[model samples]
Target: MNAPAPIRLLIADDHPVVRDGLSGMFAADPAFEVVGEAADGAEAVRLAGSLEPDVVLMDLRMPGMDGVAAITELARTGSPARVLVLTTYDSDSYVLPAIAAGATGYLLKDAPRDELLRAVRAAANHEAVLAPSVAARLMDRVRPPAPALLTPREHEVLTWVAAGATNREAAARLLISEATVKTHLLNIYAKLGANDRASAVAAAFTRGILTPGTGA
Candidate 1:
């Protein structure tokens, strides 16, 4: 059988050392071909257009046109090259915007060489890959807004119930009638796909609508 083509790579980083190191690493591997190198996002975009690399190792912070902007431009132009973010920042500020700008993968600079290589390959295959920290950050922010699933009053009712309050007690605290409390509880159960109050609370906890130590 014919051998598969190497994964063409464009290394983009403001640091010369980082660019050289990554280029050398990929060059030494038969599976990857280092097609070009860039010291900033603008250069990276330029080289990407010309070289048409399979993957671009993009750094989040650069002097001109940060990685996020470059990714946005590449996406706007519909470049075929997939961007795999390799940066030192795992904070939500950096991770969210890069992914939003069409990055195929996000990996920290401290990632093991093997992991980085795997991430690049995944990006080239059009698969989504995120570093553990980045994934956690995304998970924290990606939860459906509680208000979307439950109204303010419904949330208050559920919170009281989760705190072990009876319908009458919740109603008294909220200045509503017991009947209204029961109505809210039924709505909560249906929305949460739970059969009873306990399951509703459990579902709320699982969905991050309720925290462990929170109470009425």
Candidate 2:
């Protein structure tokens, strides 16, 4: 049987040195193939639209249009390629917007060479590739969603949980029994599509059920 082809990649970075470094990295890997290169966001989008690479290595700051805007545009244009943000900044501001803009992965520009390659491969496979540090910080944007759909009681419970309260503490704060708090948490998980407390918070944030500074 024949082996699968290497995943096609698009490199979008304004810096010639950075682009060259990345081109070399991808060229060395049997699992990856560099299909196109772009100096700015607009070029990135144009190449992505035409070349249809499996993954796009997006840079945050660029000429004409930024990576976030380009990524958003690609999503709006309904491009099939996955976006893997490669930025120097790992802040939530950039990370959340990238994710919201349909980026499949986020990798800091300082990431190890192998990790960057792995991230692109993972993204091409439709997985969310987040470095532990980047994910731990960025994914928090979606946690404890913005506080709209939750009842007042539910919000109270979430706040306590966010404050590192045990079930009994949450129960005491809400004047509810521990079992009742547990039940509410179960309900919250179901409603938020969360697998655990942290996920519940992340989902809530994504759904606007919890706000960032509301102490939830």
Candidate 3:
């Protein structure tokens, strides 16, 4: 059987030293082919189109048209090459935008050499990969808004209030005393950041804890 073709790579970074290091590392591995090097995002985009590389090792910050913009443009133009961000910046400001702009993976420059190679291979296969720190940041970004501080009882009270049910009615339905219902309402108001029933319901809706046209 014929051996699998080597993965073509385009290294993009402003620093020549970084590009040289990555190119040499991949060159030693027969599975990866160093197709070209780019000094910045614009050059990366141009080389990517011309070389049709399987993967692009891109840096987030560059002289012109930063990596996120290049990734976005590549996606907009439908380039098949997968971009794997290898950068020093792991902050949310950098990580979120690169992923949003269609980066296939994100890895910090401090990643071990083997891990970096694996990331490039994974990106070449169009699989999503992220360095441990980057993954944590992304999870923090997407994690469901910390569950509303309200308890289940508070939620029930708020729902009833939204449905125009009086405290007495809600208490009766929930098998609780009217005084208890009032206490629950007060807690709900505090948690929802509202001063009154109307504002509480509106806030609940805005917070996505309550569906519109449902509590009614």
Count of backbone collisions in candidate 3:
0
Model 3 regions more than 4 Å off: 145-216
Per-residue CA lDDT of model 2 for 1-216, tens digit only, reads 988999999999999999999999899988889999999999999999899999999999998999999999999999999999998888878888888889999888889987887888899999989878887885575577554567778878977887779999888877889999998898888877888999887887776666777563
What ranking of all candidate models by lDDT puts the best one first?
1, 3, 2
Pairs that collide, model 3: none
Question: Residue 160's C-alpha lDDT in candidate 3?
Answer: 85
Candidate 3 structure quality by residue, lDDT tens digits, 106-200 = 99999999999898889988899999998988788779877657888888888888899999999998999999999998888888788999999
lDDT of 1 by residue, 1-216 (tens): 988999999999999999999999989899999999999889999999999999999998999799999999999989999999999999878988999999999999999999988998899999999999989889889776444789889999999998999999999999999999999999999999999999999999999889999898
As a whole number from 0 to 100, the lDDT of residue 44 in candidate 3 is 95
The alpha-carbon lDDT assigned to residue 103 of candidate 2 equals 91
TM-score of model number 2: 0.65
